[model samples]
Target: MAQRGFWIPLSLILVFASFVSLWWPGPNYGTDFRGGTEVEVVFTKAVEAHTVRQTVESLGYQTPDVVQVQDVKSPSHFIIRVQEVSSVTDATKEQLKKALCLTTDAAAAVADEHACPSNARATEVTFSPGGDKISTRYDSTPDLEKIKEQVRSVGGINLRAAADNPQIVNQRDNHVEIQLQSKGDQLMDGLRDKLGADTVPAQPLKVEWVGPKAGKQLRDSARNSVAIAIVFIMLYLAFRFDLRFAPGVVVASVHDAMVIIGVFVVLRKEITVSTIAAVLTIVGYSMNDTVVIYDRIRENLSKHRGKSFWDIINMSVSETLSRTILTAGVTMLSMLAFFVWGTGVIRDFALAVVIGIVAGTYSSIYVAAPLTEWIDKRMTQRLGAKKKRPSGKRRAKAVTGKPAEAK
Candidate 1:
């Protein structure tokens, strides 16, 4: 029981530190929440992150968030994230047009009517005459293969010439389809300049872009999901256990979530949709651990009615400690593998899970159990005090100096 002195203050300190971290610097939202662009490129050969970052910076853009993606199943890959821009610049559009013209000229004379169309608006490109304009409008850059397929379906245009010359590929598109042009094309050019022309032999593996409004919606959805999960968990615990136990479980679950978010903020890790999933997972995990300890406490109360409240709590915790350790330990090992070996989103997810498991275990033992004990003790004291007070009939008799008649 003396350990409560240490555990209580330690929990408070941790909760306080987590709150500070949450508000001071805050979590770094990734492309999913914060409107931005993410490009995943797989190189024919290995490339360094610094080289990639430098190449992106030289292209007159802000410092990019560059990460080297590694996984057992996939080849070496790099994912680059940059703040979103409204559209590619006019200069970039002109440059791309000139490059495309040059490619077309090499294949056929620029004056040749058969030469591939050049200078299509950045949003729409004419792949074949009398064919529908290829709609380039998208949240992100459209895939070249997808574009080719659309063109083939509409006009049966030959893609061999465009495939041979990369410049002929329209990479930019405005929201309204006028011509084919996209920010992705600009990024591709920049990467090619630095990583060697052959590095990006094909289009990037992936491209994602989100506007401000969409990002806000995503951010709100992520937050609402976690909030809703907590509420439901609280309701479930209240129904399954005593109402007094529900608060403790809810508090412990929230504590686990806050601590994980705080660590992410402190480390400046990007929060993505995967992060929301991790937090929800932590909520469920923390609740499970707390429930085990709570069930033991309930059992101990019934089995050892004469024992003091603190003593019963201590006994219950002591009995369940081994089970809690075993469960959390095994789960932690799996999460650890993901944190160490997985890449990108998987690594982030694993890191959150690892932090969460540790926090959840500690809170279930020290925070949740102790809170329930305190609440129960307070309720007992209040009931004891009420019982000691004079009855209303006795008070009336004393005031009137006469015995009250039976109703």
Candidate 2:
């Protein structure tokens, strides 16, 4: 307990260093937090990670991430992720508008189709302001296929169906509602053309996209959830113990989070939804340990009435040491199993949890318990100071040099 004066600040310094590191270089944000396209394809033959990456890069994408999926036999699988591809340009808008407005049903639409709106019959041509939407309420129900063909003819721009997302969304639509999409189809085509047709295949396993707007929302939600969890834990600890103890638990939890993130920063790995889940799990685990030791401290305080707060804290932590070591060791061993065998994100999550376990265990003792004792000691001194202060009128007199109610 006496050495805690040395330990607590050391932890703080370490956390500060981590905070700087996290912001300075920053963490690698995943597709879930940054708008991008992710395509999972099962290659008929083995392909190197760099080879796959180069194939995508040659297509003019900004350094796509190509990761080989493990635990598969025969056909190999790989996931490729790239930044947002299709963007609305002035040329796109003008060309799309021209395609919709200039082309006539007689010239372009399917023969004798009454739904096809000719260029003369088309009355209105309007584009959505501040968004990628072009609505054309026709004189009649326009031939959507003809319009699609016209837009498709506008070459140089890589565009795919709103429906053909990654593996063709199973939704039946009129193809009227149009929005910019990630070029998943183009990427698959590129892969097939560059590599072999047998290797790349027609349909990939899956394709998913996260737009910039959606990514921002997910990022904000993740940050808010983490904050909410920490605040609630602090509130629960305060109700369970007291203000002094509650702050210690909260600080210790933050300490553990910093350390876990620091481990990732050092390893130069990406922070994904899985990583966030692991972090939340670690917070709960560390909170449980701190709560256990604090409950013991409270019990000892009541039973050993003559002992100092510092002494009780030391005794309480000493008693829980066996439980802490055994619990942490067993939990860490399980995490190690996952780290060894689990692939990709699973491996990342396991490694994160393992780091948390070690950090959390140390924090329960050196950080949470010692700080709780320190806060109690300071609060006790403040209350004693209040007791030693003079009566109200005497205090007023001492402050103002004179008092109306002078005794």
Candidate 3:
């Protein structure tokens, strides 16, 4: 209790390290918030990450990250990330117009002149609100099959029309909407085309993409949610105990959060949607640990009213230390299984929780307890100073919050 100042330096060092590590190279955001494409695939045979990286990079994609998934069923499973793919670019749309003889380049370029004819092409090609559904409007219906084939070949085979086939909104006006499957098809096609010898892109694959606007919204919402949570927790603590205890809990929670985040930043792990979930979960978990300590201290304060404030904090923390360790250890061990076999996102969540448990335990003692003690010390000094002040008309007026009628 007397040597609390010595321990404060350690906490400062940790915060400094975490802050520097977090902001230096910055965080690498995942597809959920970074507006990118992610593809998960399984290779037929065991392959190294670098080998797969080369294969994917050869498909005109520059330096796409390839990571091997730790799945028991498929040892060769891998995930790939591409910043953007299957974009409905203006160039692709223009070529679609040309191939349909809507432009001058159509007649020579397209093979079936009779079936396609002239003056027969889509008037407009527009993407849906979500940008996955593509609608093409034409003055008259051209050949659907040829249009599908030409659209597939254009813009480096990026856009894929789903097998569900194009749905015609208007037969007379030739308004058709095509569902966009994924850039994965093109990715798989490229992989199979390039790696037919290797036979990768093996069985089932999954892909997901988030638009930039949508991703930003998610990121902003996640921050707001975390902040709102902390505010509520602070209010709960204040009402539950007092201002002395509430600040410590809030500070400890924030410290745990920053340190855990610093950990991911140091590891260069992407802060995915799952990671955010883990963070929120950790806040509640850490708060629970702090509350346990605070509860114990509050109980002891009543039992030992004569004891000094620091002595009470020290005794309370010492009494609860073993319980904290045992509880945190069990929780971490449970998460260990998830770390061992869970997929990427699950593993991320598990890893975060594990780190947070350790951090929460430490902060509850060193950071939270000490902060409360310091606040108590300051408050006591103010009280003692007020007691020494001259008890005259000025003090009387100040104390009563009204003027003294006579002195």
Candidate 4:
């Protein structure tokens, strides 16, 4: 009881951490989450973090939201995200390439490959036949020559070319669109091919948008899955042994989980999809460890005819100590490998597992088993069912108020 009391303060600290994270959300990268653009860049050379930002700024772009994505599967690659690149032109793309390319050979080779900007240019050229201005909207960035020829081909009896000057209103690194003198569908189609093969309406881009919706949904789902798993684990323990046997296992599993969550919150690690998956995985993992110790308690209760409950629990935990240590030790080594070498996305997850494995091992032996014994003893005392001493009926035969006969 005295030893268990020592954990109370630590447990309270972990609880407070969980509460803080619940109310005060932490930082999440990307303009999508915070309403900005996210530019992802892959690089081949080992580079400094600040240099990447400088490169982005040199290309007439703002300082990017940079993060090092370390992939254990492929350790050499890097992923850098730059937000707010809504308009990319060929010149801008060239500038970006020039800024990011580190190797002299790589930079020099791709330096000369500049294509005329393929973004669309649109302008109102003339009034429609009904005096309503007919606006020409192309689906793609049209070739300047093709656009001029198409304009001349449209002869001006009903449709007259009003403006021949092409201007880029919106630009992006990969795609652009131009306004035209006519609103006719045929003209829009003719302009589509010249806009290059990659242009699409902004609607498709919206479909590609990664923002609050996805992140929130992912966060909520991860939270719910952990909760449901714990509830079911408690229910199973209650059914198998007794509700009295459940609190210990549930508390221990929760302790492991809270520590993991608290560390992540403090460190400000991004809770990616992989991290969520890891949280769910650890729930099952830590619960399994607690259940093993609980199962031993059950076995000892049925097999040991007269041992006290606390004694039985203590013995069970002691007996399982070697197994728990061995399993957790091996697992910790593997998780350590993942943490050291894993990509940024999954690194936090691996660290969480490392924390969870240690916590789970402790709880199974110290928290869960001891708490089980504590609760069982208190319940027995309350019910007036303390283990009884043997009656003196047999002693009377030996005494007989005199010397007893030898067997």
Question: TM-score, each model?
Answer: 0.74, 0.80, 0.83, 0.58
TM-score of 3: 0.83
Rank the models by TM-score, top first.
3, 2, 1, 4
Candidate 2 lDDT, 1-407, residue by residue in tens: 98887888899998998899878788777888877888888888788888999999998899788877775463377889998534456777777666556344445554534434452123344544322344454544455566655556666544455553212111232224444333677788889999989878788988877777778888888778778999999999889888998999889989999898887987877787888888899999999999999999999989999998888988999999999999999999999999888877899999999999999999999999888877888999999999989878888888889884745
Highest-scoring model, TM-score:
3
Q: Give the winner by TM-score: 2 or 4.
A: 2
Q: lDDT for each of the candidates?
A: 0.72, 0.77, 0.78, 0.56
lDDT of 4 by residue, 39-122 (tens): 333333344556555554554445545565665443323333443322333453333333222133534434533321222232
Q: Could you tell me the lDDT of residue 138 within candidate 3? A: 67
What's every prediction's RMSD, in angstroms?
9.2, 5.3, 5.2, 17.6
Which 10-residue window of candidate 3 scores lowest in summed lDDT? 100-109
**Runs off by more than 4 Å, candidate 3:** 91-125, 129-132, 136-143, 146-163, 168-175, 202-204, 391-407
Model 4's alpha-carbon lDDT is 0.56
TM-score-superior candidate, 1 or 4? 1
lDDT of 1 by residue, 1-407 (tens): 65778987877777789888766887788888988778888877767778878889998779688888775564558888888544534453444333233332333533542323333213332231211122233324434443343334423123333333222333453232323324555577667877778776568888777766778999999989988999999899889987889888888887888888888888898888999899999999999888888888888889999998899888988999899989999999999998898888999999999999999998998888888888888898999999877677886787788877778
The best candidate by lDDT is: 3
Candidate 3 residue-wise lDDT, 335-365, digit = tens: 9999987888898889998898888888888
Where does candidate 4 stray beyond 4 Å?
A: 21-40, 44-47, 54-64, 69-78, 82-209, 385-407
What local lDDT score does residue 249 receive in model 1, on the 0 to 100 scale? 85
